[model samples]
Target: MPFLRNAWYVAAWSSDVSQTEPLQRTLLGESIVLYRDSLGRPVALANRCPHRFAPMDGGRVRGDALECPYHGLRFDRTGRCVHNPHGDGRIPAAARVASYEVEERYGAVWIWMGEPERVAVTPLPAFDYLDPQENETSTGYLLTRANFQLSADNLLDLSHFQFLHPDTLGSNQMASGTMTFDEVGETVWSRRVCRGEQLQEFVANAYGVPPGMAVDRWLNVRWDVPGLMSIEVGVAPSGIPREFGRMSYSGHFLTPETETSTHYFFAFGLPKAMGEAARTLVEYAVDGLMTPFKEEDLPMLEAQQCALGDQDFWQARPVLLSIDGAAIRARRIMDRKIATEQLEQQARIEQCEAEQGGKTPMPELTAVPIDCSALAR
Candidate 1:
């Protein structure tokens, strides 16, 4: 899969990894294992052990070290082999595994599957709603069998809501409203404003009004490169200012597991002032949003993937739609970024060759393929 290698991708929720339980997941086609160390700091490493290529997640955590289940070899958070129960306690020079830079913030564990130097300066997408003081949010995770970009495309284009989520999120306003698309730097956003229209029943409930009430509503969605989208939705009495209305920020964070799968993390957040009653309503709203996703979206996306077979997305030349502007912009941004990275990597390789008198230097290995059948024997 051609992915943005220099970007931060979510590995798992902070609550998903623990000192006792290790999380095994694939990111950008790399197998990653995550767990909190003895000191409660999250650690991400290549899931395979060097000795016999056993899965590190099959082992147990002892102190800050991960012990291999195959032969009891142990490795620490830095991916250095710390203990070897055999061979006179002498560890092999090449016994270490790969370790990824990890950051635990915004209620998720983010893994930098890129160059370590880039990880320090790479800014993560702001999820202010996940902050404890500003708002309360209900989060859910969905594992889907579709490329991450497909999910992003689904999100950036809201026109499909009329048909896909007819009962909960769709309305005549979404179909008839004038939509505007804009791109600023690496961000692409789309806005739709409807005046004096009957809001969707789900939106009306969240707005603390009757289901059929006519109101002014705004649906503003922003898309950042790679996989971050934030949607702001608000509704109020016609001609009333937004400050006096009910609003929510719905966040979507998509992380690619492979070319064919994704880890989708979503949050529906409302202000703290909403109180307990509003919280209950938000829960209902979340369920309402999830229904179309699980029942309608997932199956459709899976079928789309099946139809594509092994063909790349752009290779298929998808039919352009009026609502696809934002999604297309996002795809272009990502494509340019990926192309730039490929050029940079080739330059580094050429530079290494020049420095070494036209000989290719030994590249650092991030992972090794082992024959599981041999290990079984």
Candidate 2:
């Protein structure tokens, strides 16, 4: 569970947090409560109260601060204890929770679980296509009982779709499709093209393809660090240029809840130029196709997790196939990044201890940003 803490991870959708109540979610194994302040800006803080260790989510939002349900101590947006109804109303210096940096964009609230200083430089993975003003978008969340990497692998290597989702999103053409993998800086790209085949009924309808028509279908996926992916799927008449085809864009943002669970946020979008009919088609695909596909994927992922219980993924010695190239590359990249961060952190701690003449208190970690501008697709 050595997460790339310097990167941004989706905490909740914009619609999930409101000014009236706090939303509790666990990310990177830490309990975080999210709520909007008086001005309707999102706020994220450690969920545990400093006094009685009560969860802040159980308390009510009082303007820009959250009132502790246990003893009525109030914590402000900066996580400072501003109101103490106890004896003398004197707040202890330690009566504050850790506040995390958060940003609201592309209809999701992203949290930085790592060093605060790096937040300014580590820009969020570009997802401008998800802006509602430019495109018709629908989002959904699924809590999968599986490692975030496992869920990520599922998206990176889509060969499983032919077998795992034959009825909705797959076909024999998928296995025979031409696939390629490439890396441009920190981003990983996987592309597949199937020629002269009819897509699944719902998929064809979503792309405005006529029944029984043979088309060239393409699936292209781009992966950013720490499990952010954008997928483009399109279909064109056999011999036509892909630019003239019907296409849809989707995003998959994975945030680990723990070593064995992940918070999956996904969105499907179509250009507003496609009109209301395309919007309705996207909604239908979400409800009719994606919903059922989730039903199929979750159980399989959970079963895989149960099988690998307590054992590391590499320690389990999974057999790799040609289809696994993209997934394996992504795993190696993430592993290297996490290892580097850990080493830098240890060095800083050692330097601090040496300067203090003993093992004194450790100072805040200052992380160097990992530039992912090349990963923006």
Judged by TM-score, which candidate is best? Answer: 2
| All candidates: TM-score | 0.91, 0.94
True-structure lDDT of candidate 1: 0.81
Q: Point out where model 2 deviates above 4 Å.
A: 359-377
Candidate number of the best lDDT: 2
User: Residues 259-356, candidate 2, lDDT per residue (tens digit)?
Assistant: 99999999887778878975796677567755655789988999999999999999999998899888888999999998999889878667655655
Model 1, which residues run further than 4 Å from truth?
Answer: 359-377
Reference-based lDDT, each prediction: 0.81, 0.87
Global Cα RMSD, each model: 4.7, 5.6
What are the per-residue Cα lDDT tens digits for candidate 1 across 47-91? 999878999898898889888889999888899999999979999
> What number of backbone clashes does candidate 1 have, counting pairs of residues 3 or more apart or in separate chains?
0
